[model samples]
Target chain A: MAVDKNLPILIVDDYKTMLRIVRNLLKQVGFDNVEEAMDGSSALTKLRESRFGLIISDWNMEPMTGLQLLREVRADAKLAAIPFIMITAESKTENVIAAKEAGVSNYIVKPFNAETLKSKLQSVLGAF
Target chain B: MTPSNVLAEQKLLRQRIDAAHAEAAQPLSREEVGDIVREVLTTMQGDLSAQDLGLYKELESLARYIQHARREIAAIRPADIRDCHLPTAHDELDAVVGATETATFAIFDACDAIGVIAGGIDGEQGVKLTEQITRIFEACNFQDITGQRITKVVKALKHIEAKVDALVAAFGESALGALEADPEPAGDAALLHGPQLPGNAINQDEIDRLLASFD
Candidate 1:
């Protein structure tokens, strides 16, 4: 499947450096319309304010965690259907199960290289 | 007075003085001596008169002096220990600052890579740019690795703090003992300066190779 290059995407991570890295990586893989959030709450605010085709989020964060954000997204009628992917350092089986239960489209563990990110994104977007 | 009686009186006086000195060396608190004085007076069968008063007065004065000396000794120990700890705390702070500086440089390199990739350069130039971007990611990875090292360093520093606290507490408890013991103040500062672990020390060439994998 071919990913829409123009689709607005939101990337969430507490680290500004990681956000920039993911944003740049996504841009390299032909997704130019990408935005960023430093945490889940900010991401939610951005989601409510604007439309995004995909949500890629980091799991560990202060205040509202990624899982909480994922549940919130799925519970909302307007935001429920937006494709959500989780990117995190927590690679435990239990954590993966919890994310799957909470309705994650895909999961990627760090420190992932460019190709791994591409394939994961393609797998979820069905564009690989 | 008879010569034999005079000699007995002198010997008794000398014994009283010796007991006073011994009591002075032990350094009992004020409340402890009150009960001991009561016990001694009761045991003396009401014969405690002015003739025996001098020795008791002398013992009390000596005990007071020992207590004062103990306090002075206690007060000086931590000041001495802290004199050594200050420099070590400063050194650890410097190490943390250095780590932060290295992390900042890594952030700059990552930003530069993103800029190059955004410029839309292609061909061998693009490949080099991608190579540079990979280097940026490698730097990012180092950032995480260095972060872990910093956490370990912080934990070690915390352990140092705990050790210093324990030492200070022990010094406080033995203030009186230390006064009598008169220990030579050794330079224990060296003990606090433990083996330094390398933090944020990255091989530039290795990072370059990791980045090359993207090509």
Candidate 2:
């Protein structure tokens, strides 16, 4: 399937560094139209306000986590179908299981390069 | 009789009577003595420590608390054997900062290298180089996030230092001030473990094996 590169993707992480890194990786993968949120709460607000093709978020964040965000997105009728990917520093099996139960589309571990990110995006949004 | 002789003889007689009265005074009952001791100990709760048995009891309790705190500290040192502590909280925190520092430095170094390489590029190639540079600039945001995290750690350490200083001030540095053995580093919080160091954390294959076991 052909995925639009201009879909206005949402990238979320509590750490600005990780956010920038992911965003750049997204650019390298052909998606230049993107937006970033610092944490799950802000990401929720952004999701409600804008239509996004994909969401790449970190698992560990204050106030609300990526898993929480995934659950919230799945719960919301307006945002339910948007593809969601979780990026985590934690590779604990329990966390992966939880994210899967919450309807996460894909999972990526931290310290990932652009190539790893590309495959994750491709799995969720189709051929990039 | 002479006035001087009268005074001296009278003083001697008074002294004798006083000595006799003191000797004749009744001994205190154990219950009454207990009450006095309780009162004294109550007054010295946080202020003064005495040499009596009651004070010794209080010291015994306080020593238990100190020992508990010392044990906790010991458990944090990966090198300490008392507790089967591995990768203690201190080590985890240090690893976080160290890893972040190294990664951040690498990012900056890469950007510098790119700049040096970009200098030799001609006009047509400059456009692509500019895009790469822009990406590098965007990636520098890690500094702000890392700074916030490190600041949080420093604040916690400062708070601990203040409490320890107060404890030292309350108890003399010699008996109470003697530093206890360090704690061994061990896993405490299972879920909240951040980026694990190379040897410390299991890789994807291990995680997959764990997952497959359940299946």
Candidate 3:
């Protein structure tokens, strides 16, 4: 199955630079519709306000962490089924397990390239 | 001697002799003996009290000296190290993050511009240039990792600074002022502080292996 190139993707991270990088990488991977949220709280608000086909979130955000956001999304009836991908510099076993338990569709460790992003997207959204 | 004077003198001597005789004839009463002993002890105690007063004064002076030394030490303490130095260090690190982020974004902008230019080309050179742009994007990721690593160092520094400030607050800087500092680790030994931050001890592959266990 071909991945939807027009699928709206939300990329959440506290770092603005990281958001830009992810946006660029997503653009490189042929995903034109991408939205940015600085943190999980804003991401949650965006999720409620609009629909996104996939969520690529950084785990180490303040106020509301990505794992916390994942749990919230999983709990919400409207957003529960949306595929969520966790991206983080924290490549710890416990963090992965926590994200896994929280119903993350896939995980990507940071310093990842566009290829890795595309691969993870394909794993969650089907082959591109 | 005049008869009257002689009689008076004799009478005085007689009285003294008689008193002595009486004292010899009748041993001192237990109450009298006790009074004599008590008097001697009272005198001795008075002497001891004088000696103790000198010792007590010396002790009081020593206590005062200690208090004065503490105040002096506290005065000499670099009171602003925590307030100025540590916080400034943190701010400097924050600035470094900001500067790097700016530079990284600029690099991204150049890469994006090059990417747009590359998109216009029709040959294999364009494809190669596009591939090179992806490499630049990947390489630019160092900014994020560097920022995270610097943040960990900042946090560690902040933690130590907080502890020092707390100790100074509780015990006065004087309490810790006299202590000698331990030598800092050198070379790679400094980095041996056992996985102080996330992703330090383990790699993504190891994490994945561990996660496979959960499955």
Candidate 4:
């Protein structure tokens, strides 16, 4: 699936540093219009307010984690169809299972390199 | 000499010899021994003279005092032995461990934020930042998972900080610059505004497609 360059993307994490890093990576992959949120709840708020072409969220966070965000995104009538990808240090089987169950399009383990991220993205987008 | 007188003299001689032997057998006299010790120690201490006999006596006293101190020190147990309560040590260890865990988690959180940001931007700048963040996250995970070395997290954070600063500077120069240059600030301002956009006008399919890349 060809991704639209103009589509706004929302990247969520509690750390501002990670947000900048993810935004830079997405820029490299040919997506320029990007946005950021520090937590799942804020990300959800962003999702509800504007159009995000994609959401890349950290799995662990305060108030609302990535899993909670994924569930929220999937449950909402208008937001349910939005693709949600979980990025986390948790690579446990149970966690992956839970994320899959929560309607995550894909799961990327922490410490993933650029190739791993790109391939994972392709797989999720069915662009691979 | 008379028999009694001879016996007394022999006894006196014997007692003198015994006294000498006893004095010799014992550690030593504080004064005479100090001379000998001073001779040996003076080699280490540089120089000495007979005039320093008073000083030598003082040194002997100090040595005796030190011997007593040595005995006292020997009587006491070592710190680890005296305070061998595992619970308290464990508590202290746990405090260190807890701090380590917190620091590790913070690095992980920072890396997560980097990943999120990398997922949002575009072009060479994005790739570089993404790679840098990925390396940092890898370093952090390696420390936590393999080495269990929490100190590595500090190094990773430092690396992330440099990258973040670079990105922020770039963002200010490019994105902020463009916004400032644009005559129609309204459209650009809307993008700069927080997540909430107007209405449900956003294209879901595009969003889905974009997010799919993370998968």
Candidate 5:
């Protein structure tokens, strides 16, 4: 399918700065219809309340982490099909494997640039 | 005589006196009593002096050790570490996170304003300006990473502060018992050490390679 730049994107992170950065990066990449949640539980609430085409989330968060959020998303039949991308500072092998096992669509390590974000989004959403 | 030898000599003397009393048909005469008194006094003078000297030496060693321990513990100044330095360090790191967050948001504000300014122009210069603003947005992400790193440091400082507070409490039974007690992190979460410091953790390229291997 052709990429839908207008599709709603949900970005979840505990840090305000990271959320802002991801939103700005997404805006730069031509995806301005974005929403944010501070942690996994809130993100899940938002997901249940509304619809999102893609989920870009930080792997680590309080109360519920992104991995836990991914597991929840995968378990829910209603929300399981949405593409999920994990952006995290946890660069350990096990962390990546765990996210993969939990059914992440793509992974982006921290300190990434707009190019990386764009390419990852393209890979997940089809070519822009 | 050594302290042990003195003890042995005194035991022997008691035995001898018992034997004498048991064997005698009559009570000890004056001369006999005087002889026993003289012998007891002579043995006691020598043995007691040696025993006193040995005990004095041991007491002196103990005193020295106590003095040294006192000096070392005093030098730690647990009060200062717990009350002053640790709090200062925590506050300073908190300040750093706050300052960086403020600066990062300010940068964001500037970038947004620049984007607006760039929107008016209709040329490559406008495109270039927008790109530069995006670059600033990406660079501003440093605040998030730095904030996480500072949080880790703050946690370590808290652990250290806990230890100092326990020390200041003089390791009372309750304090000592609680020294090693930290709430156990649940399950896989235990393995999650937060963002590694520079040079300590794997890079993005390595993570990408590992993820590719899975594919």
Candidate 6:
């Protein structure tokens, strides 16, 4: 399977800086079509309103966390298969295991670069 | 009846005084002077130092703990209160330090990335780098966020100090409590910012591997 750089991606985080960084990293890795959401609820609204190929979100947030967002997406029959990636500074084994069990397409940790993003995308979406 | 012994002591002291007077007026010897002076000074110090030794001990305990706690707070500077000697205040100090380090990291990492753009890269690369810089700029917002977070800790510290002050006053605490009020920073003591939280810092590679393990 070939990854599509043209597909729109949504990046969610409590920090605006992170949203921008992830957006840039995605663009650097040839995934240019990126959007932003400050929290899971907004991401869900956007997910319902518009089409996004992927969701990359931070694990810690108020109102809703990335994990909660992932769960919501997975539970929604229409949006269940949209390839979600949980990105966060939290590396606790229980958290990762929880996300893994929750049906996340993948996960990424903080301070990652373009190459890491590219590879993660490839592993999940196949070579592009 | 100590008449014999008492009479002999009075006569002996009188004889000595008379002898001294006869030669030249003599003042109390150094030992006598010290004893007389000590009586008055001891009473004054007791009045000034504390109501009693027990209260003084209480005061000492508070002072010593605050001093020790401040050292722990100092260690918290680079983040992580894991090394603090006093466990009671570890969480409080760690909160302030962690927020401080996070803010510092945001500033430093932003600057470092901006340093990376030396020249021309085109299309996606340029766009990505541009977004990266913008993101770094956005990260600078951590200052206000962390500053706000730290303000709460500062408020808590002040509140605790104030309550301690009231306790001291209610207990007739000594002037030493003022040291905390007008804290004199000890020695070359500045908050030492150490390193990032080992748990929080993870590179993208690690994430990739973790994700692979999931598969």
Q: List the residue pairs that clash in candidate 6.
A: B78-B193, B78-B194
Best candidate, lDDT-wise?
Answer: 5
**What residue runs in model 6 are displaced by over 4 Å at the alpha carbon?**
B1-215
DockQ of each: 0.11, 0.07, 0.44, 0.12, 0.56, 0.03
* RMSD to truth, every model: 16.6, 19.5, 24.2, 27.0, 21.1, 21.7
Candidate with better lDDT, 1 vs 3: 3
- Tell me the whole-model lDDT of each prediction, alpha carbons only: 0.74, 0.72, 0.82, 0.66, 0.84, 0.67
Output the lDDT of residue B104, model 3: 92
Which residue pairs show backbone clashes in model 3? Answer: none
Candidate ranking under lDDT, highest first, comes to 5, 3, 1, 2, 6, 4
Docking class of 2: incorrect
- The docking quality of candidate 1, as DockQ, is 0.11
Q: Roughly what TM-score does model 2 have, to 2 decimal places?
A: 0.49
What is candidate 4's lDDT per residue for B70-171, written digit by digit as tens? 344333322222234323434444455555456766876776688688778889888788678756654554333332232344445446555545543433
Candidate 1 Cα errors over 4 Å, as ranges = B1-122, B144-215
Candidate 2 error regions (>4 Å): B1-215
How much is the lDDT of residue A117 in candidate 3?
A: 90
The sequence of per-residue lDDT tens digits that candidate 6 reaches over residues B52-76 is 6555456556656655654444333
lDDT by residue (tens digit), candidate 2, B1-215:
99999999999999999998876553333444456666877777776645566665765566566556654543443222212232254466666766776686688568658867876887868658856765665555455456556657766765665665554444334433244554545676445756766697788999999999999
Measured with C-alpha atoms, the lDDT of residue B134 in candidate 6 is 49
Model 5 CAPRI rating = medium
Cα lDDT of model 6 overall?
0.67
User: Candidates' TM-scores?
Assistant: 0.54, 0.49, 0.67, 0.42, 0.69, 0.46
lDDT of 1 by residue, B1-215 (tens): 99999999999999999999876765466657666866776788678888667767776777677667657656555544444555566566667656665775677676676766646875687677676665566356444434445555766766766675665654454542354433555688544635463653446787798899899
The true-versus-predicted C-alpha distance at residue B89 of model 4, in Å, is 14
Give the per-residue Cα lDDT of candidate 4 at A40: 84
Clashing residue pairs, backbone N/CA/C < 3 A, model 1: A1-A127
lDDT of 4 at B71: 42
Which segments of candidate 5 are over 4 A away from where they belong?
Answer: B1-67, B171-215
